[model samples]
Target chain A: MVLPSFSNPGAGPADAVVAASPTAPLDAFLDNQPQTFYESIYRSEAACLCILRLLPPVCRQIVLHVLWSHQTLKSADLKAFCGMDERLAPDAAEEVIRPARDRHIFLSLNHKGNKFQWPLSDTFKRGLRNALTGLGTSNSFGAPYARGPRDEVPTAEALTDYGEDTWESILKYMVSSGLTNGYRGGRPRNSVLLLLYQSGLMADPYDRSGHNPKLEALTITSKGFQFLLEDRQTQLWQILMYYLAGKQARGENAADILSLFFSLGCMQLGQDYSASESFPHMENVLDDLEQYGFVYRTEMGRERGQFFPTHLSTTLCSGESGASRSQSADDKRFLILETNYKIYAYTSNDLEIAILNLFVNIRIRYPNLVVGRLDRRHVKAAMDKGIAAGQIISYLNSHAHPQMYNHPPPILHPSVTDQLHLWDKERNRLGAQESVMFEFFSRELFDETRDEAERNAGLHLALPAKKLLFVDPNVREAIKDFIKDKQVQLRGGI
Target chain B: MSYHDPYQVKASNGTLITCDSAAKQILIHLDAQRDGPQKFIIRDVDDTHVLIKSIYVDMVRTSLQEELEKNTYDQDPAL
Candidate 1:
């Protein structure tokens, strides 16, 4: 099945705009083939928790209400939670259940001689309950370390710092590939790189089918461009989903692996947990995750070593935007766009520079900043690579410098925004579209054919003066049949 | 992230109809509804030569409608 577009079908202008821009993990799941996504989710407990977290607040509530029970919950049963009285139609309740059902979060169960009803996902049920209440006996919430001198445990601030640094380091690794001399740091773990290739976020230019590490042959795919701008949680879920799917394919117990990680996310940040708590499940993957900074380990040499979940893990379930100011506060300002085409990003973060270099022409570099201009060639290069003008504009708009942000409209210069799109639109000026070219017909016949094709939404281009027309290939057969019928009629009449 | 829409603006009656051809490019800016003077630009797509001058709103509208009716201008007019 084709991936559904990121845009919501009937969203209003404002929502349509948001939907047009990429980076929604929920939308990604929706856009993905259901069988693949469902298999991915059910294979791991953490993937289940991720689906719960990725859903909108209302949808999550639906999952929570039905989570405890194993019985098939009728869509009508949800009426009590929603307080939709007898006045509300049963179909309305079904409508309420539709989104979750569509996403396969609620599987339809076939009870013997009974109406089909949505069954709460068991793996998700257990994992979410443990995550929310922290009362479950299962090791799904992470194991607590034996009482230790608390002074040795790392603080939340330190973990957040570690998470940010390592996360940036991974991005730096990715961004380096876009540069002339590739990024020189110790690369991210092989598993993470493989996840990138599997997720189609990055591809080897020479070898589209397989990756060879020795050649360092990978270019960030267009999907990678948007992936770079995703918030940490979305990025984490995207990566983790791919990781779980890959492991599951290899016959590993990926479901347990996912659950173990979800437990890690549920644990208190900076709290020390014994490795045995998560046990055999976390033992192998924990080292791989360390490269992602999802967790930090102290005293790796010891058998019962302690692991602390970083900000990345802690923020996985509930993002920080739950506060009253539900949207972002202007705390993050990474890019500055000037009135002129020049862009001055205030941080020599190599990853950020490499990303900017993708669509913006870099002119000069400084210790703290890199100066760049977004010209036609720079924009076309990104467009040619499959990154849309809208995504680049959205990234710049979101990451605009604090001073640049004017309340009603975000702070990037209007010209820069318009020109980026204009350049992107320019790429579409002569895009190749396959169509059936019709020519050498009489003027009267041509007019008749053109009118019929246009009415049917099959006409591609028409040259009335030349009595030539082009139409969609699918409709060509019909036109040919009509022409044959006309020829027969002419012969019969003659 | 909050985005500033450069194309869309509040309460501006100005409409920009851009049409591309094999030989030339045209941009017709009509602001008659907003009671502002209008202009249109015709330039070679190959960047050979440029022609820019003011035009009456009716002329731009007629030209735009002619192009629109012919289905040559596939892009919707930007408001």
Candidate 2:
């Protein structure tokens, strides 16, 4: 179940920097969970495998090494095992060992001799060993369903289409929700609709109480706009994270649900699993996931039905491979931007068109081509609604037509990208700072006060003619003392 | 030399507005309209800056947007 690292070998230095931490969504989610939750999560072999695959390379190596031995490890022992030099050992211990300890993967113990030692959690060790050896009776990896010749299972292509269609409909709902007419497509399930609202991706502007608002009433929030711009993998993980959070909030068994997700992540795509045998208690969870396009289930016969994990579920832990494959399949380069700020998109898909309509002013639509213009107003409107300039540019660049890529670099016309940025910047023309204003002072008093303020590095603004000064609020008392001293000296001179 | 307070220090909540000279002029014009209960601009800081009541920041931004839109040429239609 150990999936290969999906970090692109051809990625640049920036990607390498990001790869250093390798903070997958699962890693971030696990980091926030309490120790008790980790104990629960470690009980499932599939969940253990998923956590191992998601850990940073260094930490994964350390965990594997600790899995076989009963010996307690000290800091120096871990450093030596990592093969680090003396100077870098402490730093490595801080950067790598600390997070592992915090994650409860490593248990620190006070030995009888007053020496501190780290041991792997017993639950994690047992689960991981069973996952590696394939010797567990837990059936956490899923039990295969015996299908007869007459039983019709979906082809991989159909499953992919099913997943994509269901997932895209959800995205389409989000995008269309922002429109004046609102989303007209088939609405997602009520649970999903609630999750969308709870996640703050969509909000009901009219509903003050926020209690189970209708799908039509929900508008795409700023977070939703940003979510639409993310690659499919990140977007899916984000939704799943929100779904888990909602489950936890509703007093559900989140650890069990989480373990099920991890098992689903490790399951084979296109293989039928006996739903009754594997997850008899998780019927509601499976049904909800069906709405989210994670699994396709057959109707129940005399016995409980079989469910097939779609590409979405199998590739959950595989990360970028799934995203890149899906991108190549459906997210081909289709946009062309010109120097005149006109955009031509070669897409007829309603979902793609809806996403484009978020920021582009469409002029006309042919059968397979969309003509639009990047107007300041439309871009500003999108920005006001919570989309960033960088997101817009990156979206355009990632989706630019192949012809645009034929040019050396800067695929989109520089003028067009620059204007889009300038349009965003125009909204931020006025910078505001809060300060205390000192006005109506005599020229002599103003000069003296300004000098003292400047010396204290507290002056915000100075107007010689108006005899006014705005100083930092932090230095007001000191400026007042200086002014009072000046007044006393003037009075004594008189 | 009179016995009055040498200077007055007013602790009013104000936002120091910073922008280009052209935008500052538009802001000055906006302050002069006095459309709300109070004036928008507290003091003209300089050619390129102004201090205004913090509450009026959004009002100032919208008016500026409308004004800028009028002056800006539509490049898309030009082609």
Candidate 3:
């Protein structure tokens, strides 16, 4: 509270950054949060874990180093820590402090000589320290089952397999609508499925029951297609954001719900975490977790149940366990993209087939495999649906079979990558635009204006012999202004 | 007039559908689970003004899947 300078709370940056940072999916949480919201979050041990997990490397180092010293560091010190000089103030602020500062993650104080001091909240500092050391008495982290047997605990590997199956069911659920007879098995937990519809992930077809709408029917959206291809971490956060938003709309405390998620994330997989001591909302949290396979609940008689953290539970924490689950999927690369524009994907996974269909024209589906081609019409169809060409190429590159990566630098075949990009660029070449067409009797004025404006290249088209010009509509206003000024100059001369 | 959004265009034989040109949102025909047989995304102008396309969750999966099955056949290479 030295200077109380961390004031200009940033809902604007939060909202814009969250939705706008489509590349950084984790930034979605930072969206639409006011300073007070962040303050309340920082005060809780569980919520602080949520924020601390997403801090970029440099910001993390600074927070940890600052929190440990129990002293505020000046903005200049932060700048220096980022290896930036005083002259590079803007870059330093943007690269080092802006995200945390914008989110009001750091408390800023005005010290002597106009320097600004930044520190972590005491509650946040204590919370993170306790999480790292497992030292605090706060029950934010759920405890183990009472009188639980040591012999029956599930192993991490078993939890991971179950995590993959159930979690992937949700993904498969999206594409099922696209596949003939693809929808199968019970859908994801009712809430998660509803969240999909509610979040506009997968949509239901048209309904007009007049005050009673249909919720059973569902289909994937273009955004849902994009979600399928996103890195696992981004996909998880996207669901959480939508789910939490829905919960909050129902009048629940969002920060507490988030803290519960983060606390569960930080726990050990396969361990039985107790309920009564921590997580007063234990029943609700477990019910939600069961859907996502975050925890397995067991009840003995009338007493409240004990919960176990599945490997999926660690999806929110560091990528170690998450990485293990991902490696299994990534281990045997399913896709093979050839220079001849042919695609051979080895997998019975319907979700992969549906995604491949986004940019590839499938030729045949055999047992355990499918063959396809990256054709012009297919690519354009994807583009028309708002899926970008670059996304297609990268998806191919990441899933390329191991043999394909044998070349130096280990990437997709250069010719295939080149052709994919070339096709994208070629198809986008011809575009129609609205323009202001001009015709004049005076050749001199027309020639002069055309010379000056057409310098923008490809933007202005002229039929010189006919004394006509077509100016890009965007530049029409600017050209009008220029003409008015020219008329003023001519009048002055007269 | 804003052409009453999802404004329909007539085909030569007299069915109202959105033809290729000047169409923003794709007009898809669907057999709605709740509303019975109908065209998706686009509905009768008389329907509620609140029918939002974004939040509309059902898709014409059955018909679309039929069309996709045809596509799967066409894509088969000469063998």
Global Cα RMSD, each model: 13.3, 7.5, 13.2
Chain B TM-scores of the candidates: 0.26, 0.77, 0.26
lDDT of 2 by residue, A280-315 (tens): 688778888999899997675225568988888888
lDDT by residue (tens digit), candidate 1, A1-494: 12223332223233244344222543553555444446654444455666676566777777876687666676456677777784565556667767666667776644445343567656556656655665555565566778555536678888887888888887877777766687667677677778787878878878844746333566677777667766455677678777777787889865466556656666787787777665554577877777788888766424565678887777666633322111234434667887777788887656677778888888789998888777666677778777776677667876788777564563665667666656655554422334565653455566767788887788766667655566676787787776556555544564
Candidate models: Cα lDDT each = 0.61, 0.78, 0.61
Which digits, one per residue and each the tens of the lDDT, describe model 3 over residues B1-79? 1343121111111112212221112123232343633333432221111111322322322344344445433334564
- Identify the superior model by TM-score, candidate 1 or candidate 3: 3
Give per-residue CA lDDT, model 3, range A1-494, as digits (tens): 11212232122232233233222544555657777777676655766675765666677777777877856777777777777777755434655766677667676645676666766666677777887777777677666667545536667777776777777888987767655577677677667877787787777666554232355677777777767776565676677778778888989888777777777777878677676665775577567767776666544411556667776666576634236344475654888877778899998876678778878889899988899888777876776555655567667766778877776753666666555554554333322233455554546656766776777552345656756555665676676666557645644565
Model 2 clash pairs are none
Q: Compute the interface RMSD for candidate 2.
A: 13.3
Q: What is candidate 1's CAPRI-style docking category based on DockQ?
A: incorrect
Candidate with the greatest TM-score versus the true structure: 2
Clash pairs for candidate 1: A43-A255, A46-A258, A404-A411
Model 2 chain A: weakest 10-residue lDDT segment is A1-10
| Candidate 1 displacement at residue A348 in angstroms | 4.6
